[model samples]
Target: METTPCRMFPFIRSKTAQSKNTELTVNGSSSSSALYKSNFNLGTILCAAAQDSPQKTAIVYDDKIFLSYKDLDVAARKFASLLMTGNYAKGAVPCRPEDRVAILLPNIPQFCIAYYGALYAGCIVVPMNFLFTEREITGLVKDSEAKVLVALKAYGTEPTKAAKKLGIPILWADDESSCGMQALLSSANPLPALIPTSPDDTAVILYTSGTTGVPKGAMLSHMNLFLNATIVPNTIRPVEPDEETIVLAVLPLFHIFGQTCMQNTTFARMGKLVMLPRFEPGEVLRTIEKYNVSLFAGVPTMYIAMLRCPESDKYSLGSLKMAISGGAAIPVEILKEFEQRYGIAIMEGYGLSETSPTCCSNSVRQGRKPGSIGHPVWGVEMTILDEKDQPVPDGQPGEVCIRGHCVMKGYFKRPKETAEAMRNGWFHTGDVGIRDPDGSYRIVDRTKDMIIRGGLNVYPREVEEVLYMHPAVAEAAVVGIPSERLGEEIAAYICKKEGHEVSSEEITEHCKRYLAAYKYPRKIEFVKELPKGPSGKILKREIREWHKKMKSKL
Candidate 1:
């Protein structure tokens, strides 16, 4: 495939101009001046697209609900009007500018309408995972201090229960019920215009995964979401002006990867989005073939499932132009196999919820490396820094730090945590990585996931990557288990492929061949499947907890 050098933005110096030893940061800024705009609204992307292409199909859901750009815009405006007027039901209060409006729904059309509607009303959007229980919903609602919630009745009574407990009004979006979003939209007039918003005002409060502890809301400003949504697509794919870009939305829209990269990016380009409420490998493959999906963005596990689907050979995924991976580090073996089989490039990127979720990515325009999360996106600078926040040399592993237009405002209502994370003007991502000689970055592992056995440090990704190389290994997660002798011993949880069998000793020997004595997994346990989050990233925190529970029983 043909490739170009990474684009250099006008506002920042080129990576080549900086000394690799003194400043190991890679800059992926382009020459677009709009990136530094002062006043902007996240909702403007949808409005602008609607104005430009009123008849264009904006979203296609399950081959049933097809929304034109104008239709989508009108629905969003109506929803915004309802929020502004507080006329949806009794005891409802008008949502003021910057007020948090939580949304608990799946990847349906209602999610898009509510998300943009909240922003159009100049309200901060708090997108909650629909899978969250009543207690989890209440905790997030209390933390965000959300004024109202837009949820689906089909998701059950949890959302309503949480809203009632908090004394906040909840709007239901049930297609089957009369008291749904459609009824509310029909009764309410369309909002004439979007509320004026400053670029610095928080548009969305995306809570962290809370893998370590309590989830904190990351305050993403209009500018942060705007630039990231604009840069990532232009850098990676660069859709033609007249080209029809069709995207598959299987990843949960509540996640930053799906929100900014898939939804917002597609709208900015006047592209069509095919929505799937849930990801079943067969359904995803069938949809891709049915819609001629040109772009797909998902977590690593999503790719693995589609690749391993038993009847995958029947589907001709020729329309797929590129596959974007994020949310977690994809095993290199899976990346290579999927690419070779599908005849498409998988561009892996890296970021946290705090960075509006995309700081670095492997671009088609900019040459992509297989295992590396390519250079920083346009207007972003990423560098590996030591514990003291000093720049680390190229090829040396350190905590990845980022700064530029895409960094979030701060953790909502948590000044001390924000201060600690944003020390020295750079948002310190707890991910350990090494800067490649070619200006790309490779994630080593999470700082907390690193295991110290005897006196040697071992990255679980390194072990997991090797385990993925084994033929019978269908999925693998490596975690550190407490040890009385070695501080912590490396433990591997694996899922084997169907009709294949592999002993723990065989898996151990496979790792021993590639890894050092201290780095290899000392304990191996086979399971039917590994636990995954909403976006399909493996949940190491849950695995550790399960291990603890089993140990107590022993």
Candidate 2:
């Protein structure tokens, strides 16, 4: 392996380049001076760490299945050895750095093994969400043109049949259950050394849920994800060895947050991971109390369910030292109440799939303020830029722009979209927000989702927060509907608690008490469920489509 000088690494680019978009400044400081790189790959470093701490427990599931550092190393090595045999060649013809390999599996131990196995074999991993429809899964696999796929028994032959239809080979880790160490113990060629990859090398290509159009693959490199894995852990809370940091892994590993926080961070620091196949509010509570888990990461809805649990007082949740909420803006009401009830702080962070997911996070050590996503993680530079690409004044809302090591390489094979996103070296996140005098930022709304009612700009987050204060509302999502008078009027989709019902007029009346008359929801639709994306975020685009369909019928 060739070692490159840190200064010469391509990941660290020049910061003084003139911006194609106008510069954004807040309180006499310009966003143009900040720069970042996407150059560190985490999996390679973590596997090396496993060799360093061979006897330490690295993974624990169901409080029974445990794997030490040594055990993980052996499994990965043996799996990589198996992959190296038969028609496999590192950096060979037809398998260049740009080629992709699909990984279709549930959140099992083998998922980690297969993920690292592909990296060890020098192939870019395309992690598929296991719950995706057959058509969706097939579209992603075919679009990415993946050569090999690895899955487990829990995933039936459905994916296999799909792979066969595409003429791609599907290898099952089913033998893992019965074989134990046999496959690993069998002598095979030594695992190859880490491949020489630049900061620009394609690492993982994640496909976005195409609510508006065909799904596009977001390409992230080793450097992109690796930097996030290191920077996020260091920025939020320092990892302490022998601290007994048992993490409850309920978030799907396919999502970038789980991939970095639960898996990579655990390996980087040698912490124990307790895996859950699926999230059950009761099961999650039991696992935490039983394991004395220290670290918990989840979305707002998960926290709401746990706090609202009928037996909430029965569980010993005091063991949780820190929790992180992302995926969407958490209501300020929920934040205050959850902390007051649970005796633990829920730190909020901001990121997108395009940023290798983490850019800013609230600090656990620092006292948190309501409705803030804290400060930028180490090495991240955030700016609130106006439509002209100029920075907004302090406490003013604009599009949230990020420059960081956690940024993804580009949209896979889509240069035009990549160019539009990565303008002037900074990734243009479409979400709008405002930076505080203290450096924290609060998301206002999506750039396109902001409603202009009677020429009064209303952020849905503000309106949503007011709706969340209602006791009968279990889940709520706000969208804009076409209106002849206001151009776009606020329409809300709400899921009420079981045995609890509220009329649209009453809901609107409740909002009118808390919000401006123009900002209050004018139309409401009661639904059993809201549309959600692969990562558990409300799919507002779907809601908009539904609204359009319903209006067309009228």
Candidate 3:
């Protein structure tokens, strides 16, 4: 039998002979087994890839800037030297376990330099979204107790003000003649060597979007990130070091997907990443044609926009092999249309900031099944539990819980929250899902999002799926709005097709036939567009809050 690579090594045929770092091979064929290994540091993985492919193009932007492994090393060294000249100490930066260093920048080389530089200096990196409001920005900075903030020229004001309010210094990377990279690389100083970080050391303090309330910092360790990046790519496909993989990095690096998949994963595999400040469908298609991009990752909204692009067919996207979708659920209809049109499959995955953002993903080799979030990644365990916290039968909807290496250390400084979320050694994902007989999982809806109407529980996804079947409906989101009679009533927010028109009565009538009497949406609102997060995820919490304010006015 021919041998193939395994993402996670399987155990020996004899069960009792397992080793910590054993590589499993079955019947003289590696493809038949998975590999089991001990955890490694994420920094080591990045440096190793940089060393292995010293001359390959690492990043490409508007002007086609390419950073060879050697170049990145030297540039990082120079930036490191500049950082060392500051309050940052030579060894480990002497930070308390939860100390945060805020990073506020756009999708430029400085973001990476500042990010890795902070980590190399042994300070916990808090990557703030550059689009945050002043109050929101200050709240996170004060909450995290960030000592230093790095901001790009375009979005430096908010960070500067926040830093000033908090009595912290801001490092601005604004240059007319040269960019942040030019300034950092031109500095005459010796870069410090990489810090010796343990796998359990807190590498980043990723602040959640705070969709629910004030955002809380998710403390991810080197091990948490290392496990995710190492396992995700290997399971999806075996990437060769010499393969010239061009990745379209439109997703923000501050988000977990872009950080792990595009930044760290690309670095580990020695692939080239083409950066974009934001997603413009035509521009993305043009860039794809221009650079011959091979790999792509984005949220569902991007795929929808790209498909709706009038000039989508004008570009030759034959180079695209795979596209990964996360941040929100990908509609099966959209997935089919994209695959049919572009000859590329968008593999949908599921995760949260609490789990390094990639707990499950559809496998490229194993044919994607519509609506499934695929199997669990290597060294991770997943289970579906009922409201009572007891394991539910297969094919039954329940809350998804995750455990193992990819699980975050915990919420930063929120011991009560950490304890509540990680009960019984499993991080309780608020999202509800069901496991099929084949071990694939499908998310039903969020546990908190289930609507209770006159004592009957209705999963919002069930109602949304029905609404999506409507011919005129372009997008739909279901939420529970407070009602005087029913306690909570199902409210459907709809965005219709450009030329089509639909009324609230028609939507309610359409739902009545396809859904249970109580499951049908009682109230409806038609909007030109749905409110979305930076990643294009429908902000359900934001919608719910808006509904609450409207009801209050009534």
Candidate 4:
């Protein structure tokens, strides 16, 4: 193998040039620069890193399987060969460029192999949540029009059923069966080279959480994901020359937060990734200490669980350099307490599946803001806009708008919705936020999640922030419930800490002291736990369903 210069920090400098059939732009006008290569493929990051450091460990799974970069690259090539030659299963056809390949797996090594393999073959990769049922899997697969499905053997039943119904072949990983991915890899020859792909070619199709309606697949191009994976780390805190960056991959790989920020970013820097199939507070701490992890990223709820873990202090997490929080608005109270307890700064960022998931982040060099999402990274422009699509002044709340190299091309097969979101050359985020005079942004709440009671607007995040301050509260979700008098009344669902109990009246009184009459939750319900998505974000949609059931009973 020829040695390739490790372009660890491609965006460090700026140059504009033209490649084969496309224009390449590398500019330093923004705080973060853009690196757009016309003849580029996302899978090359792994191949280049492997050539640069073949013997270095790339992935450590469950602290048992340690895969070197060379081994991982070879495995990805074998899988690509399987896709390109139509040798995986009966009735399978050779995949063409832009073909959709669905992946239904967890945060294991096979997920990485299959993901990069599909990209190497110049196919669009579609990742699905492993927890989805057969119905959910079938719906997503059918919607994506995927030519093939790759899933773990343990979770293959539902995906296989979906594949059969859709007339697509399913490849099982980690199975001793004759049809498993390993068996096919043993019989297939490694692809000699990665298929050429243009920077604008769609590389991934990430589905949104669909809080408003049906989930839409966001189309991210090679340039979008590549720029985000490289720019975010340099903008926030670049890895030092002598330092070894080890990332703990507890966040679900299917989610954008983990896929781009954690997995792709680690590969871009030639760092080691420690994979955990699921998030358990105790197991997370143990893994971090055992592997001497330097970087960690997770949602707000993960931090809350780790803070509340009784055995968290037993592990000396001195190696942790920083932690990132996203996926939701983290309460200021919890952020402060966790930082004080663990002595690690939690840098909050903001992005969506459409923005390659890392547009705005609190920078280490700029100093940390307690509640702000910080400024836009290099190559990204963010502003607050009013309902008229006009930019709003500083300190005023409006819809957050972003335009950047990291933004997705558009939603797949939904031109109308795409046009609605990408109006005025900026993507309307649907999130209400305020911008500081210094350019920092703070999330107010989602426009759909805001509650209006008696002609006054109430943001659930503000009330939930106060609720998190309660000593006995472990987790809290605030929502707007139906009311005959007011348009919508505030409701709080509280999950108390273990061995601690608090009444609804006590919780209401605590909120009353801090919030106004309409801002405090009028009805408080104590629950054992709150519904969370794959990334451990509190799901208000589920809570709303519970409220509907309770109202029907009443």
Candidate 5:
């Protein structure tokens, strides 16, 4: 039995916010209108677009599968309809809008349908990385208390293990089985009523890098996501009205960078998002040449990888007009070389999962500055503040704090940590940065010893925790070493237990079994003793400096 459409969806069409431009300010001065409608539900970004252009192509899957806006809406409705059955649906258990539903998927049409579908049902979406190991996935599900897990068919056995362990219902997409996505979508049941959510209600719970402690989930509200998503497309890098916006969504959709920047922005713009599950330099070139992709939202290493591809010049990627660089800093030399080769301007930005993943970015207009993340986007206020929360003088390095509409609601289930992070009315990003004379911000370094390898954040503590579990390992300190190809390469320095000898190859392979492929340390250095401060804390900075000196000599 399905709820009546009229009762379920109070507004069949997306409603515009009453105070349209009421949510923004420029550097704490002039007020700017909200970029997109924040008053409405996030799912309505697709609904409004579907109603406007039902037959327009919205999703392209590896250039094989295509879904129009109407099809996507119906698909979302179908997926939502399954969740509405209150245990009557073949695969899904009763899922209320308040319950968390963790999504584990790669870049595919199902990722879009499942994400929006969860939002459509009024459920909080907890997006998980598809490359996570069984234990990692299990921990996230347990932490988030996800009642129902939606995953693609190719996820292998990890999802099943986690679901069974958690005693939760698992819905599989791309499968024709009874518990598969198609079975639910094919149901004749009507769509459920929309569970109206407040703008401040948490829309997504994005997990932060657990460098200092266990990864904390950042609670991003509907307004937070909506405001941040709009700034990039509307102000930072607006697609020309006549241009058919084709975004290369190669970044993992589970991360906030890809979700808000590529996936949501494309749908909001009523443009096409080409889904590539995993990034391959060769295939990326092929997809661009085949589809004439206009927007390439990628990290610094991706650009380096593409340039290093053996078939680099074999394919014509001339269609790319605008590019976005984030995740990690790109060497100015590499940035210049890439633009010259690709003939596209790569605008740099800085953000984290907490700030809807975008606090400061370079706009397409006049404020563009290479090697510097441009001024705070409309409605967002960014500052370099000292420990006392006082604004530091310009050109001086300090903690980057962002206060704006895009700031996350708080950290989920961890109020103390949230208080620490969101103290004094500013979300403190533990990144050392300087505010240049032109108000543009440049990242000097990270206060937190986090590593960005190939644009994926590799928290040293997480890797250290894993290494500590090995029987042969007594103590381990993980650090990042510079690399031209990858922004940084992970290196683990270990002091083995007496009488226990383990080969580096064995340790690396062991890590591969437990961690993601990119997370495993590429180099393992056996040391008798690691440098430590008087307080007994490992001196990671000293180790980094040591590596730099050694590399220079080599």
Candidate 6:
């Protein structure tokens, strides 16, 4: 077989552009360790380091499934081979180049294989939340115009029903039965050629939080994701050659924050990724202790849960060096307690799915303020904008806008929405933020979520901060509930610490100490837990809905 000429990613070839201090040999390749690329596809490059140390542990799941770099490559390629060649068991799906393939699997080994394999086969990947219901799954598949569905047997008949309704084939993961990922991986067919895909091509379509309406798919290009993945590791802190960073991957892989920051970054450096299908505080602690994981990227709730875990001191988490907190603005109280408890700092950042989920981040080398999402990274530009879409002065709160290489191509098939978000060459994040004198940005609240109480605009974050100060409060969320007298009254929902019997009266009294009389939550609720999105960001919309229903009943 003759080989066609295909160049590696252009950035890697420019040796002069690379930093001499940053240059370190990796993957047994002459290329600088910072540049991880292959066939201009996100999948192929993941295995480049496997060529160097095929035996280096690539993935670990539940302390049971351990796969080396070589094993991961073989499985990823074999799955890609199955998709491209279409030679598989009866009723298996056959996908052509550029076909949109929806993946609905938990954070299992198959999820990684399918994620990279679909990209390798020149198919656009649509990673659906494994927790999505049948209807939610159908909506995403229909919206993306997916030609096939790759899911797991644990999803029951939801995928089958959705696939049949959509007139597409469904392939199951983990199972060895017909049309299963295991069965296909065991096939004797040779791995297929890595289909050519342009850098501008959309590699993945990540769905945003459907807070306003139906979730829009953010189309991220090959260069969009690849550049962000490489830029993040080096721009923050370059990992030493001998220090193979082990990342605790508890954040759902389907979410953009976890997918890019945790999963993709781990593969770029040929580091070990310890996967957990779900986040159980004790289980996560045990896994971290077992693996000696150094780096962890997680949301605020996960950190809260770990710190609040009664047996947290039992595990020796001294191996942990850094913890990244994103997805939502973490309460300053939670951030401090976590750092104090774990003896590690939490690097907070801000980004949306449309921005490939990370643009502004607290630098590892630079000093970090408790709540401020430190300055824009590398080529990314971040500015606070007024209502008129013009830049606001420093210390003035406004909409957060971002423009950079990490931004998505557009919202898939939503030209009008895309135009609305990408006006004036910047992706307007609906969240409100203010820049401090030091160039760090602090989020006030989502513009839509802000409460106007008796003509006074009260940001929920301000009230939540006071609630977090209460010693009994483990987790807290503040929202605006409709008020007959005041237009909108502040409501605070809190999950108190274990063994602490906190009351609504105590919470309301405590908030009065720090917050202004108008900003204090008059309506205090003690709940077992808050509704969270895939990345553990508390969903305020659900709280509103629940309040409305409860009031109607009363």
- What lDDT does each candidate get? 0.84, 0.73, 0.74, 0.85, 0.76, 0.80
Clashes per candidate, residues 3 or more apart or on different chains: 4, 8, 6, 1, 5, 0
Q: Give me candidate 4's TM-score against the actual structure.
A: 0.92
Error of 1 at 548 (Å): 0.6
Q: How many backbone clashes does candidate 3 have?
A: 6
Which model, 1 or 6, shows the larger TM-score?
A: 1
Q: In model 6, which regions exceed 4 Å deviation?
A: 1-39, 88-93, 552-554
The lDDT leader among the candidates is 4
Per-prediction TM-score? 0.92, 0.86, 0.87, 0.92, 0.75, 0.91
Evaluate residue 351 in candidate 3 and report its C-alpha lDDT on the 0 to 100 scale: 85
lDDT of 4 by residue, 124-216 (tens): 999999778888889888888999988877877788777778888888876766677767776555655677889999999999998999999
Models sorted by TM-score, best on top: 4, 1, 6, 3, 2, 5
Q: What TM-score does candidate 5 reach?
A: 0.75
Q: Residue 518: error of model 1 in Å?
A: 0.7
User: Which lDDT value does model 2 have at 218?
Assistant: 90
Model 3: residues with Cα > 4 Å off, grouped in runs: 1-41, 87-99, 176-185, 240-242, 552-554
lDDT of 5 by residue, 120-173 (tens): 777889998776778888998899998888876677588888888888877776
Model 3 poorest 10 in a row by lDDT:
4-13
Model 6, range 1-554, lDDT digits (tens) per residue? 11111121111113322223322221233223213334478775676766787777788875555777766666666666667656544554566667888888888877887898888777899999876787898999999998777787777588878777887777777566644666556642324345677888999999988899989999999888887778876776678678877988889888888888888888888888899989889888898888899888888899898898878999878888778889888889988888788788888988888887789888777768898888888889999999999888999999999898989999999999999999999999899999998888999999999999999999999888888888999888888888778788888888888898978888878888888888998888889999988878899999999899898321
What lDDT score goes with residue 257 in model 6? 82
lDDT of 2 by residue, 1-554 (tens): 11111211111112211122433332354323432322233456556666687667777665556666655554554445445442232222233334577777666777777677667655688998876656777889888988766665466457767766887665655544323222332333334343345666777888876654798899888878787777677779876655866788888888877887788777776777788978778889998988788889988888877876787787888898788899899988788888898888788988877888889888866657779999888888999888888889989999999997888888877899889988888788889999999888999888788988878898988888988898888889998888888778888899897778789888988998998778898888899889876556788998998977776421
How many angstroms is residue 30 displaced in model 6 relative to the true structure, after the best TM-score fit? 30
